[model samples]
Target chain A: MKLLSNSKIWAVAVIMLSGLVYIGSCTRDNDLIVPVKLTQPFAPNRGTNIHLPGTMTVGDPTQWKMDKAHSSVLWSSNYIGTAGLLTGRFNQFGMHDVAAAEMLNYVATGQPLLDNSWAFNEANPAQTFFSGYVQINQSNTGEPGRDGGCNISGMGTTPIVAGTQNLTVTNLAKIKSTKVEFDASSNGYIVTFDLTWQGKLAAPLTKSIVGKLNYITMTTIATATPYKVFGLQLKFQFNCRDFGITSTSIADKIDIECNMNFNNK
Target chain B: MPDSFFAYAEWVELETFFAGYLLVYAIIYLVALNRPATGFVKTRLLPNLPLAYAFAGTLYLGLQLKNAYPDYTIEHLTAGVQLPYLRIWGLISILFWIPLLQKKPVFSLLHSLVFFFLLMKSLFLQLFTSSPGNDMARNNMKIYSISIFLNLGALILVTIISLLIARFNTQKRSTGI
Candidate 1:
């Protein structure tokens, strides 16, 4: 009742309100929020569909190399309180699912490429795995100005890297498969991998997600050489708050759908 | 948003709502411009102190919002909109305090122009540029148009408020009320 009588309290309230704005700008990265575990096996969805130019093949996963020229990694996240979805693509990425060194060593010895000589056995689906990394700085959300947030760590922005601070932290987003097995329900291979994200204020956070993998055959237009392409489509949702990103404009639930194509060189 | 006060109010709807809100404030400011101050806060130091703090607070808040889009924060006028804290415009903000302390209507109007420029300069840069991503995300509502409209509308209200505040102080001294 005496609030209006005291100007000092009103002034202090005004100052404190302004202080809250500054606090809102800083990302919360100290305490990690537990991520929802993925118990269900991956199934084929519209996002993961691979329109093969040729036909399906029973190829060895170990022999496949990443076709960087044709493969792409796209990320999409829903905007908070709106039907809008923020979509972007990472320009620079490397898929090292198949061991190139061992494949090259076999070729250098004038020996035919065989599954037995490879690092992992082709007969066992569990041994078949994939590992890749994405350059955070290279994220292009179509808008060059919006891509600045990608440099901080996650696909979000923080006040720590503004103005004179202009610090560029190379936080490479990485993924490595821990387990791979055949999902008889979907009649496809299911891969469970650790998805790691690094933020400016927090250490790297890892969450396991399941993805669908399909092997398809494609013929190169230049040489007409038939090669096996690894159609690995990973569709999963992650909480942005877990990575210390609290952008009010962007939704906390990030829907990630990656359709990567890897082929033998 | 369904249960919230701003239900169905997306960026476009909010922009439209704020524009009308500022218009109402601008009209109230016009009416207050002719009225004399009856409050005991007549001293320049007493009144100008809060204005100075408000300016700093607004600038800092604007900078943080711009920080949300880092690339646009660089050299405010050239990059995009928000706070150009490090640019020449930031130094110009200091001049706003001079007119407030002096209590001169002429200088106050000039200071209002400076503040208006600071707020509206980014509107031009953002309006002309084309961002495919922004257009798609906003569902063709055109975020640039919304920003330009809000910035212009807000500045109009701010300039009017500045004039009304100057009128109150000057009228209070002249009328001895």
Candidate 2:
């Protein structure tokens, strides 16, 4: 009886002691510290022109140009719905300008072109053309970059109709190239590139081409010594084609120049 | 686990646990006042087990918050930030253990009151400050409140039963067998 009573007393004592210790240890205030932020190149600004490499017999490559108003093809798609389906009309593709920040993300993370494997057939010379799109980052004094090229033929042929003699094949391909160089002053970067496309029209009696050009520059201003770059300038070129003919081509560009003032307060 | 959700939930649980502690302590005190020693021990000790469990629960929650935000600062642990729950839990710990030292009914009752206030504060804060449609918050609040209420209720019931049993034993002892 004595031992049992003593044991119960000890149990209570132990519980009380543990609780006190826990409370005492937790009473002290914690100290505050600054949070860390990430520093890396933006995804959209990492690459040169974005385009797929393939030959398409539908249109002549000679019609392409650096000027925004004269381009022959254009297209854009953003998966906005919960099911990831295209929600907007295909005709409104290039009407809205791509944001510079978004472009930077694309440049850093996207691939621009499709390879030759996307071709329909090597035997049929006329039908074996490849078609794709590319986004290029080029500067007169810096590195040229590109992304977002899709080649349907490179995706490999899948027979849509097995029993019928007539069959439909789907192919997608993509590729990209970039060049980087510095000037005599070594103060700025320049990049440049030319993109070509050749392929059979996916739909007979109808021709379509999608293309875009964007020019951007980043410059730093001194608020503190050895200033940081925070300014961006951009221009765009778009093109579209219908029934083997160029129907719409538009150019839009915006120049944004601002100084980096770190101590604005 | 979103940091904000976890922080909010922890605060709620902390308060509810404290309030429960206070109610239990009060009930235990009332029973101890009129009851015999054996009756008091048997009725009070078992139900009080939840008090310890609440402490353990709060400790686990604190550890989780710590893990989620490794860079959690002292300011974050204080009044306005994520882990104010810890402060309430700390108070709970004091109420829980201090009673064991005094071994008096009054001290135990006081501890229960503190627990009750903290738990209520936790519930109120969660209801007012937390974002709506949080199923976890609602469920947790319900569980904590119900469990605390049930535990105290059961303790009181047991205390009443024990008192009756003691009375019967005493009447029998006073009379010649």
Candidate 3:
């Protein structure tokens, strides 16, 4: 009887002890809080192209030039299509190295960008969407490298700002040899771009646009792209104005100016 | 009895069988604890707590094996594989009945051997056949560390309890009751 009783007591004691030990083991070991270190630094190698859309006026016929005093050419587009949209930008435009490097670092570490999402008003009833990019590369001379791409979606409401209306004929003729120029001044830089666009009316309309010339000017202080972790810093001001468009047409003149800051470290 | 009682009873029975297979280490520990450390063994405790250490080691091996071959038949048996080491106290309860039954040493030893062999087979199956995931392979350091700690602690506890039991048996024998 005594042996049985003693065995029960021992058994219960072991049970209680095991319970305590199991509970202790289940708790996380708080002392080991060492952070993981990166094995090696990743080199940022890719580049990207930045694009800015422009708007033109409707009527008063006259030549317009991209104002280089208050506008700087950061980047441009390439004409990929034949007719519907003759798109291309200045080839010399490219991103600084620091901004490219930093973007690569963020990608390597799997870090999320802070606030990359924005909403804007829709421009045309037929145009369902519009997106933009800020391409970065090693040199502004050779082929540009594409580093990253971001989408601008849900821009639901367009701003009620007015566009130029008195566009003349001289501005329409200068669109053929149009070139975008940037001038670095004491205060800041200015960008001036000229374009000549002409298209016939799709019938039922009398006045066909034989020549449509347009110019855009912008000005801003140079600012580097913001990267939370690492990269090259490229700074540039944001300002854009549109010229050239005649008569009442479906297309409207548009211009935008905003700062773009990025890093490549 | 209520329906819940039957359900719980069924679960307990299933648990017992699963625990029996999973925790063969507990059986080995119980048998080792019950064996007499007589003859040349002058000390009250076994010189090395081999059975307790083996129990902990096998328990850890079982857990690792489960991780490697996660899709094995036993995955559906219980949630989290029900750490076999946790069944140690249950075996300890059964050990309480052993003294009263006065089972032969040969029978107890055979029983222990069978349990040990089953534990070894389960471990081998897991190591050789299971497709261990990337996380298990990468985090081996943490897993091994926990295994070593568990085994060491279990060995110490089992040794102390075995020593106490052996000493108590010796005292009872000497009292001539």
TM-score per model over all chains: 0.36, 0.27, 0.25
lDDT of 3 at B169: 94
Give candidate 3's error at residue B18 in angstroms: 14
What is every candidate's C-alpha DockQ against the true complex, given to 2 decimals? 0.01, 0.03, 0.04
Instruction: Count residue pairs with overlapping backbones in model 3.
Output: 73
TM-score of 2: 0.27
Error of 1 at B157 (Å): 99
Candidate 2 lDDT over B25-49, as tens digits, reads 4334444545776774545554444
For B1-177, candidate 1 gives per-residue lDDT tens digits of 122333323322322322222222232333344445643233322334224423543553465456556555446535433223323433343454555543442332233333333223333222234422222323222332353345444445455577688999999999999
Q: Sort by DockQ, best first: what order?
A: 3, 2, 1
Q: Which stretches of candidate 1 lie over 4 Å from their true place?
A: A1-63, A96-123, A149-170, A217-230, B1-177
Worst 10 residues of 1 chain B by lDDT: B16-25
Worst 10 residues of 2 chain A by lDDT: A87-96
Report the C-alpha lDDT of model 3 over A61-100, residue by residue, as the tens digit. 1212222222323333222212242222221111121122
- For candidate 2, lDDT tens digit of each residue in A151-208? 1122122222222211111111111213223322322333222222222345423122
After superposition, the stretches of candidate 2 with alpha carbons farther than 4 Å from their true spots are A1-206, A211-265, B1-18, B21-104, B130-137
Tell me the deviation in Å of residue B56 in model 3: 5.6
Q: Write the per-residue lDDT of candidate 1 for residues A82-165, one digit (tens) a residue.
A: 768878787656653323232221212111222121122233566566666555656678776667653333444332322221
